[model samples]
Target: MPATDRSVTEALHKRRSVRAFTGQPVDPALLKEIFAAAQRAPSGGNLQPWQVTVLTGEPWQAVKDEVAARIAMGREGQQPEYDIYPRELTEPWTDRRFGVGEALYASLGIPREDKRGRLARFMDNYRGFDAPVMLFLHCSRIMGPPQWSDMGMWLQSVMLLLVEHGLASCPQECWAMYGETVRRTLGLDDGQILFTGLAIGYADEGAAVNRWPVPRAPLGEVIDWQGF
Candidate 1:
């Protein structure tokens, strides 16, 4: 067994989605430790389905530049091989999604009519949301819906680990839009497909965007206990 600090649990509980990041570099050793934590996530029938490409330093800037260049060209870029959202969102789910969007845009001071502002902010996802570290997560092509669910668990594990390290992470499903180009540029194998990207780094405390706290549904709305 190894020694651990008491701050671990507290960090997990207090973790929040950080939209702004400081330019300071994250420690390589801690990054490695976080990946190790991500690997420990459970999988379906023990078939772990997560491959992560951690980007930093020059590699990160290279990817960022490529993405920006493509955007400047008047291209919508590659579409996701799979649909991120449901064909139809019903009732509470639809309302919840809209609520989150409204809250996020309000925080950024982008009014409901500001389409340009929204697009510009959305583009920032490809730029790692201005975070110095970007993690692209992929899974084998053979994976079905069950494995994708497994992938979500792995992503959650990684995000929690980032929080425990005093770092923040935003998992962007929109990254799949240009992930094909990112895959080819990064020289990844064909069997692997990017499911999402994560921006990880210390939160920029002075940034107003990170100051807004988005509300979450209560336990009663999300949980039901039948066994008593």
Candidate 2:
């Protein structure tokens, strides 16, 4: 399916953290159009702090190779620029994270006891779930939490735009685990910090991993409507 004029609500409903993608390559012109529109995404104090490097073909393969080599060296090879999650995640947040993970594994038919199976699947993060393109997001090291929040908004905008264009994506913070490797492979300066990677392509909708039902909290649990 090609891009359509979709409503924001429709785009929201269509968007998913797609884990499987077809081999079909996305059109470069379409990608450029979507990203150009995404530049309008709101930022705090008009500071558009998000810096993205879109990769495909040989460049993307090179990054995966570097990360794979690092993975072979074990945990000691990791050089994360920042913590992907809080040191002590508690309560609802922890439960939510665990629930999604369990659901994903269940959909893949990997039981909780199958440690090796699960590990193999988890390692797929480095492959961008085999998506055709990888958008590596980074920002200046000097950017504070507020700017980081702005980056999140920008990412959301991009994802929604992708959905509207009949595309899919997965925002992988797991890339941050190999931050230094990515920086070196891309020849990024020390002042820049790798934040995350977005895998984009046509979704493999028939795949079990892509078909899993991702749950969301009810509005009451997340929203506070005192005025209403």
Candidate 3:
């Protein structure tokens, strides 16, 4: 099948954070087009702070091996390049976070008491869940919050582009934990910091983990209609 045949609204509703994927390879030309389309995302002052490194073929396998090895060794001598989550999560934010996690695990039939099972599954992030393509988003350390916001817009643009191309993706912040490994393995300079990793390929539609729809907060609770 070709890339998505849906309208933007339809794509928005159908897009998901897929955790499992088929090993099928995405055509290189299609990959080029999807990324080129993402270049259209809005940027702060047109600075376009986002930079991407896509890995496939032998390079992708090698990186996956290194990451999995590090993970298996208790992730020793490793620390996150940046704090992925806030130190203090409060109120509805905490509740929402917990709810989504519980929903995901329940869908996989992993019981709350299955610590090992959960942790092992969590490690799949390093393996990209066996997706055929992996991409890392990076930006220079000199960039500020506004530039970081631009990177986020770029990331969303890429994901929507993938959806349009009949592909799926999962934005894996977990990769931030292996910052040093990623930088060294990918030959990234010290000035560049990884914002996140993305796993892209065909989704395993039959997987139980992909079957459940995560909940979202109601608009009334999150928005204020001002002067409308």
Which one wins on TM-score? 2
Pairs that collide, model 2: none
lDDT of 2 by residue, 87-176 (tens): 999989999999999999999999999999999999998999999999999999999999999999999999999998889999999989
In candidate 1, which residue ranges exceed 4 Å CA deviation?
A: 1-9, 72-76
What TM-score does each of the candidates earn?
Answer: 0.89, 0.97, 0.96
lDDT of each: 0.80, 0.93, 0.88
Q: What is residue 60's positional error in candidate 3, in angstroms?
A: 1.1
The better-scoring model by lDDT among 1 and 3 is 3
Between prediction 2 and prediction 3, which has the larger TM-score? 2
Better of 1 and 2 by TM-score: 2
Worst 10 residues of 2 by lDDT: 1-10
Judged by whole-model lDDT over C-alpha atoms, candidate 3 comes out at 0.88
Clashes per candidate, residues 3 or more apart or on different chains: 0, 0, 4
Q: What lDDT, from 0 to 1, does candidate 1 have?
A: 0.80
| Winner of 2 and 3 under lDDT | 2
Per-residue C-alpha lDDT of model 1 across residues 1-228, encoded as one tens digit per residue = 122323657766667777889888888888888777778889978898787888888988887877667667665655565778887879788988899888888988999899999988877777777899888889889998899999998888777777766778888877777776678767787888889888898889888778777788999998997996
- Model 3 quality (TM-score): 0.96
